[model samples]
Target: MVLVTGGTGFLGSTLIKILVDQGTAVRAIKREHAVIPDALVSSSLVQWVDADITDYFALSAIFTDVTQVYHCAAKISYQPADHAAMLHVNIEGTKHMVNLCLEHAARLVHVSSIASLGVSKNGELITEDSKWDDGADNSKYAVSKYESEMEVWRAIMEGLDAVIVNPSVIMGVGSGSKGSGVIFNMVQKGLQIYPPGTVGIVDVEDVAQLMVMLMNKPEISGERYILNSENMSNKELLDRISKLLGKPSPTIEAKPFMLGIAWRAAKLVSLIKRERPSLTREAALAAASKLAYSNKKIVDATGYLFKPVDRTLEETSRLF
Candidate 1:
């Protein structure tokens, strides 16, 4: 039997499908208030339970008969006004997963983020040994993820078996309208401009597969693996999307000062709009910051291959 948290999410649902294809009994945890995906509901091979992991008793009940665990649930938003809630989900929730895994003797596969390791100190493809000291500069999303990784290290000290996969910005088919909205909004709105910058890339399917491999590889415990396929400039990404959508691409690059003013103004509108601000100062910094990482370690360690960037873009574009 296998346990998958966030199984209806982009990566987790794909992982659940993979496990079901392999004839493994899969159980997943989700909120009772949330809508369950039809595929998971239709599959007789999967047991979808509505429960929150932060609740110890709920998690204890779901972990039963679970030989291996995939802890993929997470909460990353544009600007998390509720910092305490985000911490509970990302930090303390991880602590619960570690404890529950140990109690069930289940092999744990934790889904971490590249932000946890902070910026690449040398402006190069960051490897596992790269340090994260800019926890203060990054957003609450980044801080929460960084602290979550620390939780794993603490678990290792307590003799827990686990492996971590750090993925760059994920792009692919997603569940409902969540998780990938920033990218979706840009594509949906038909952007005529984008800020000048570069960012990392990874397909959702690739990340899902890597998690299964890490779960099966005993030697992967206590290691962090990066899963990035390319380092692409903002212009390049917009151009690709433009060409696919047959629309004019954003050519004029906005100056950093101009972007800052626009972002602040947009944030003010956000306060009145009653939803997340489109142009947050935090989002702008993450956008402007160079986001690239090394995936050679993941390739060499797990024998995983990535889909070509053009193909990944094409498939995901079909969604929009």
Candidate 2:
């Protein structure tokens, strides 16, 4: 059986469904009463367990009959309490998973973020080799993911058969969460105008298929793959979404001065509310950075090509 941590989560749910449809025995970890994604309803034999990732002892019992594991759970949002919680789940919790995998001798596919991949200089394109290692760098979310990946790499070095997959803002085929959720809210409010920046996009369906393909391949045992479809500017992304939703695209461009005001106002409101601000300075900078990556390695290794960004974004917009 395959054990999926955070299986009820955005990407995890879609992935689990694909596995079940293929007649694979699947087990999932569900945390809350949030509506389960449409993907999970297909397989009646699939098991759903209530467990937090940080509990290693409980996980040890759970992993007894599991042969492969998909570690998709993570604490990624920018909240005040996220920092401490992230360290336990994303870092220490992953270390625990690594130990469990080693003990059980199971194949582990770890899900990470593009945030863990270090930024490029002068708007250059990045490859899988460009990973973030040092501390005192990137956002809290980035640090947590980086540390977790470090644990996986460490396990690999210590004779664990683990493969890593880092995704750039996963879109498409998910039920209003992760990057899809953020974009959903933005488009619903007629957020057509965008900041001056670019990002790599990936449809979650394509990514989930790639993960399954990777599982059957033994050559990429210790490799890390970056899953991205196409590099798109903010304007391109907004334009496509607008077209998909039949909304009026923004005519008033977002000037730097206007963004500065909005970010500052959001920061002030967050401080008074005593919470981690949504539109923080770092997040805005991350969004506005010209971050694009090459997926040639992933594509070549798995022989799975991703669909175009426009099609993926349009499909995602049509859902919610």
Candidate 3:
């Protein structure tokens, strides 16, 4: 049996669909009260359970008869207030997964993020082998992912069969104004400021596809793969999405000082409304960082080609 965590999320649900299509029986777990995506609601091949990854007792029971595991559940946030929660979910929760997978002898496909990777010290492209700098000015989310991956590596040395994939900004449909879908929504609603950073992007389907392919290859365990497809400036990405939606591209390039003011104003507004800030200081800083990722390892390992970011944007835009 195949077990999947975060089955209700964007990438997890997409992975479940592919497994169901291949006639693979899957046992998927979601957080208590998390809504089941419509695409997964009616599938006989899928068995949905309500459980928390951080709750080891609840998660351990679901590992019964699970021969393959996909650990896609994670908490992603850049806010300082979310730091503690992110550590519990992303780090402690992964510790449970590594332990449970070891007990069950189930091969694991851990879904890590490019956020966990280190900065290229010599102005070269960041690869799977890049060293993570402990003293870098990392965000809370990056710290969580980095610590979580450490749990996986620790387990691997103890004999757990696992492979990690670090995907760049994942773009696709079904996110409904959350995740990267928010970028499309922002562009459509007349956003007029572009960040001065370049980001790597990949299609959600490609990420899901690669996860399944890796899970089936037990011989390739204990390796990490970067899943990025393209590297482009934030301005270029926004322009393409805007053109697809027939909206005018952003004209103003937001510098660091401007971002500081914007995030502070947004934070004050959020305080008044008792809601999370739409812009945070960490996010503002990240928007201005220029980084790139290399996907040569994954491409050579599986010979799998990623769909163009343009095609992914066009499809996701139509759904938006």
Model number with the top lDDT? 3
| Candidate closest to the true structure, highest TM-score | 3
lDDT of 2 by residue, 1-320 (tens): 89998887778888888898788988888775645666566568578887777888878888978889999988876654567887787998799889999999999999988888988866678888885656434778888888899999999999999899999988886656455667766766888578887888888888788888888777779988999999888787777777777777766666667777777888899889987676866666666677889899987776786988777776777677
lDDT of each: 0.81, 0.81, 0.93
Candidate with the larger TM-score of 1 and 2: 1
lDDT of 3 by residue, 57-84 (tens): 9988999899999999999988878889
Ranking by TM-score: 3, 1, 2
Location of the lowest summed lDDT over 10 successive residues in candidate 2: 130-139
Error of 2 at 149 (Å): 0.4
Deviation (Å) of 30 in candidate 2? 1.9
Worst 10 residues of 1 by lDDT: 175-184
TM-score of 2: 0.93
Tell me the tens digit of each residue's lDDT in model 1 across 1-320. Answer: 88888877878888898888888788888777766666667888888899787888888887777779898898876565767788789888888998888888888899999988887765786778888886347788888899998988888888889988888888876633565535645766777677777888888889888888888878767787888988889889878877876677887786678679988998789889877776777778777776678889988886778977778777777776
For model 3, the stretches where C-alpha displacement exceeds 4 angstroms are: 271-274
